[model samples]
Target: MFLRLSPRHGSRLLTRIYSAVAARRCPSCSAPLPTALPTCPSCSHIEPLPSTLSYHDIFGLPSVPNPFCVNTQTLKARFLQAQKICHPDAWSGKGKKEHDIAAAQSALLNKAYQTLLSPLQRANYILAQQGLSESETDRLGDTELIMEVMEAREELEEATSGEAVELARQRNRDRINRTQKILEKLIGERRWDDAKKAAVELKYWETIENAVKDLE
Candidate 1:
């Protein structure tokens, strides 16, 4: 008989394997890390760790968010491991300075995790990391895309019946999905201007989605 694993079980197994593989060692004694434990298991040296690493460095991921590939299982595994190491509560027994550092590192890790988890946020983060801002994003000059957004908003506003509203919502969902694909391609190609435009379009669609949800 063959054993079968469900998707959830498979993801959990992958996460554990990835976490174990990506675990960081103590700088002092080089003991294998189980989580982001504050002290070296072998040397018992209490030192601030993981605070010095960047978000991508902490996760063992590439510096840039890869548009073509994202392993959420790996990301989650890394996040959990980092949290274990950096959560302020984990450092409470140490010193005030160490506790404060842990708190700050935890905050940064949370921000990075949330940003990378959502496609829209991930795109915006990538653009922002490349020095693109909302004001800069508006200058993409895609008149047709702008017009389509305006038309969609108009249609949503004019929609009255339940069926009409549902139809409008579905249309907006389709537009959102299409724009997301464009955004991914633009980001993958390092086209900042076009990606920013796509990101802005996504924001509009998200607003429309919220409004439709409110109506329902």
Candidate 2:
């Protein structure tokens, strides 16, 4: 079991035994798996593992927060350090057991890094904590705003000069920044349903992010 908790007795147990059940390596060369799996660095073999594994356990964090905010850069650094240790390069000339361990660790690291990175992604993480999965596509009540974002993307994509795209980019950036403030306030109030409602709108802001990239 990944986690076993008993709050009344204050008893708990967590296991880091992913290496045992998962075959994380190149079948031919026995090369350890990399974070971006299906492509082994050592032997260039494709080996993809199932996603059922927990990202939290992959990085060795308490399943829930306690004096640890999700945005803590220190925790992020620790995660990166864990990934470094598990990188296949560290297992040079190691035995099969060692190689497998390294591969499992690397895969966990990649998944963990991806989980903790973005605010929307973080919202989904919080949703998972609540036994909910945030919708992959957000629905907004403001169809006009949605259409606006769509048009902006098309315009930005076709813009001939950086200045033209920059104008659209800045406008969308301001909108996203404003929406982010709303998101933070809702989360602070623990108004998740409202936060999720806003998140659907915020998904449109992601289009703005894409617009920014197009400008660049």
- Number of the predicted model whose TM-score against the real structure is largest: 1
lDDT of 1 by residue, 40-94 (tens): 4355344443333434444666644554245668889978876876778977887
lDDT of 2 by residue, 48-144 (tens): 3434444554444444432113554755876776566557777756666667867776766676677665666666666555566676564776778
Clashing pairs in 1: 36-85
Stretches > 4 Å off in candidate 2: 1-76, 143-160
Model 1 misplaced regions, further than 4 Å: 1-23, 34-54, 63-68, 136-140, 161-163
Candidate 2 backbone clash number:
0
> Could you tell me every candidate's TM-score relative to the true structure?
0.71, 0.60
Superposed Cα deviation of residue 73, candidate 2 (Å): 4.2
Q: Clash number for model 1?
A: 1
Displacement of residue 189 (Cα, Å) in model 1 is 1.7
